[model samples]
Target chain A: GAGVSQSPSNKVTEKGKDVELRCDPISGHTALYWYRQRLGQGLEFLIYFQGNSAPDKSGLPSDRFSAERTGESVSTLTIQRTQQEDSAVYLCASSLVTRDIQYFGAGTRLSVL
Target chain B: AQSVAQPEDQVNVAEGNPLTVKCTYSVSGNPYLFWYVQYPNRGLQFLLKYITGDNLVKGSYGFEAEFNKSQTSFHLKKPSALVSDSALYFCAVRDADSGTYKYIFGTGTRLKVLA
Candidate 1:
């Protein structure tokens, strides 16, 4: 795809269940990012992957939150034992390693009941 | 720690009037500032960025931002606001000289243009 692609435009899951959100970054981009936007709030950084370097997981909220990306392709964000507070739009973005601007996906809206 | 702040939760502007959305930041090193717009139920679209050199940076949709080093601010401006220009605006900042590449974003400002 020409732009970053995210799967499951909307997801509804019960509290305590697990969920996985996927993102397909633009081809040849070496940087990928994940963020969470709760209702009426700004984006909160989650994780960052740059090339073959170790992903910076400093922004992840908890141990239950984890992400994996293989060789700059598809990435998945997993949330275990979801809580109501976890309900938010999960956003994915990709950019060239040297570029400061990021192109974002439409985002996956996760609703935790 | 690096952070960004948008003082106004919402800004209302009349159609064809000049509009400004305020943003400020605190970073440990040189700052790379950017503005993004989010329409209803859509992803963020990059509007502009201030990386280096020019303080007044032009962006998409006829928008621009001025970077002030002394004040540590980057305010988005449009010469004339259109009804369709109304959307949620975000300001983000990253420490350019730092090894970490994560960007910190402001809470966001909702712009409403009345015709």
Candidate 2:
């Protein structure tokens, strides 16, 4: 892809519903990151992947939040039994390398009601 | 652990006037600092970064930031503010000691330029 792409630009579901957000990073990008941004808040780091391995999962808010990446090409974030607090914009970013600047996707706006 | 702080929630400036958005960080070792801007309904755009170089760093949109090692501060500046410059600004710091490649971000400062 030309840039980092996220699917389902907006999502609205009842509380406790499971939701999945997808990310397609730029081709050849070795590093991918996931973040959450609540209304009027800062970027919250969720996870990071170097190839298919996730070196950091410290930012996951709870056990219900999990993510996976395959061969550095695509990644998915899943939220099980979502709550209203889970409402936020899920952002994905890809970088040429770990230390390089990143390109971000428009993000998936998830609204848990 | 790496952390960033943006003390102000909002900054208002008049057109053509100088503007500054303050940021500070805390890290165990060397800090890789960065500035980013976000327009309404748009994703963040990288502005500039402080990797191992001079204290002063210049970036897009005529913006510049000064890295003060002693104070652990990276303050963004612009000599002449424009209405178009109004946006949400974020400060981030990469953890120098970790392989997680994680960046700790500040809460963001909304810059409003009055015409």
Candidate 3:
């Protein structure tokens, strides 16, 4: 795709359930980022991947949150034992390189019931 | 640590009038500033960025932002507003010299342009 794409535009799951959100970054983009935007709040950075380097996971809220990306293409964010506080729009973005302008996806809105 | 502050929770402007959304940021070194807009039920759309050279940066949808280093601020602006311009605005910053390559964003400001 020409732009970043995310799957399951909306997702609803019960608390304590596991959910997976997928992202397909712009072709050839080397930097990928994941962010969570809670209702009425700003974006909270979750993770960053720059090519084959070790991902920067400092912003991840908890151990239950994890992400994996394969060869600068598809990435998946997994939330285990989701909590009410975990509800938010999960946004995915990709850039041509680290520190460059980022292009964002439509985002996957997750609702934890 | 880097951070952004959007002073106003909301700003109301009439169509055809000039609009300004305030944003301030704090960073250790030179800052790479950016502005993004979010429409209802949509993700962020990049508007403009201030890296170096020009303090006034132009972006998509006829939007622009001025970076003030002394003030530590990057305020988004538009010459004339439109009803369609109503949306949420966010300001972000990253330390260009920090080497960490992380961007910190503000809480966001909602802009309502009435026709």
TM-score of A-chain in each prediction?
Answer: 0.98, 0.95, 0.97
- Assess the local accuracy of residue B97 in candidate 2 as a C-alpha lDDT between 0 and 100: 62
lDDT tens per residue, model 1, B27-100: 99999999999999778999999999999999999999999999999999999999999899999999988997
lDDT of 2 by residue, B4-50 (tens): 99999999999999999999999998898999999987889999999
Runs with alpha carbons beyond 4 Å of true place in candidate 1: none
Over A4-87, each residue of candidate 1 has an lDDT whose tens digit, in order, gives: 999899999999999999999999999999999999999999999999999999999999999999998999999999999999
Each candidate structure's TM-score, on Cα atoms with residue i matched to residue i, is 0.98, 0.97, 0.96
lDDT of 3 at B86: 99
Q: How many backbone clashes does candidate 2 have?
A: 0
Question: What does DockQ come to for candidate 1?
Answer: 0.89
Q: Each predicted complex: what DockQ?
A: 0.89, 0.86, 0.79
Better of 1 and 2 by TM-score: 1
Structure candidate 2, residue pairs in collision:
none
Model 1 clashing-pair count: 0
Q: TM-score of B chain for each model?
A: 0.98, 0.97, 0.97
lDDT of each: 0.96, 0.92, 0.92
Best by TM-score: 1
- Candidate 1 lDDT score at position B49: 95
TM-score of 3: 0.96
DockQ-based ranking: 1, 2, 3
How many clashing residue pairs are found in candidate 3?
A: 0
Report the C-alpha lDDT of model 3 over B8-105, residue by residue, as the tens digit: 99999999999999999988899999999999977788888898999999999999989888899899999999999999999999888887677888
